[model samples]
Target: MSASRYQDLVAKVDAKAKEFHERYAAQLQCKKGCSSCCQPGLTVFSVERLAIREWLNERPDLIEKLKAQPGNPKACSFLDDEGACQIYPVRPIICRTQGLPLSFKVNERTERDVCPLNFEKDDVLALPTDGVLNLDLLNTLLVLVDQVEGGSEAGQRFALNVDEVTRT
Candidate 1:
């Protein structure tokens, strides 16, 4: 699986996220070392998993650093003791979008959400529609990218979470 397509998607996501963060800086409490949203059980597309693996492979120092730290079962394995992500530069798309306003459909109903720490001073529904990321669309794009990257192969998909990424 290749990461070129996934990296393209990441670029788009990062642009959108940057715009939202800039526009909502005052309302967002997200900052360095804040990992309330970095929880366990978060899975990535095969493209993303491959990307993480490739990134780590290129950085043996980071691998050693991650190994040196004590992993917390309660938190994401990539999270450091200081709550910073050990693989921040190559983090998955979902991680890139955390703390941003997101909209997705569930049971034929549109659901919107944000990090509770954010938008506390304003109503989520009151924000401009363009201000929120279309999570469904993002996920669809990610899946397509994954499929193109050979993630459709048996057992190579995103069945494992970040913890397994560390182990394997």
Candidate 2:
């Protein structure tokens, strides 16, 4: 995709993210330093892999820093030792939806997980009234990626080895 187009999508995604945060701020108490979701063994989609690789390619020094880090296996390539995304402005949809009350399909069944902090505090009651949590913005970004590279090809191709990329 063209850089201008990517920038537009990034802008929209960032706006949606800010709106999401505003809509959920009262119900979510997940402050900084909480890295519950930044665990090991998370498999990102090929598009995300590509985006991170592109980001790293532009910053060779950061790649070297990541390689030198200890015990950083299979985590999101964008995550730093401080447990924050290096490219927060362009983080993937899944990361963007971390604390929302959203639903997803698994084996033909819809399941939900209220953010642990929200669930524990009886904040689930407020989520329903917070308006629709549509993921269309994210889906649109993915579609754009697919258009740039054929969908099937993009889905199957993994550009970087997570372990090798993370090794110092």
TM-score winner among the candidates? 1
RMSD of each: 2.4, 4.2
Point out where model 1 deviates above 4 Å.
Answer: 1-3, 151-163, 166-168
lDDT of each: 0.80, 0.57
Candidate 1: worst-modelled 10 consecutive residues by lDDT: 154-163
Candidate 2 C-alpha RMSD relative to the actual structure: 4.2
Assess candidate 1 and give its lDDT.
0.80
lDDT of 2: 0.57
Q: What pairs collide in candidate 1?
A: none
**Candidate 2 steric clashes:** 3
**Superposing every Cα of model 1 onto the true structure, what RMSD results?**
2.4
Counted clashes in each candidate structure: 0, 3
Instruction: State TM-scores per candidate.
Output: 0.89, 0.69
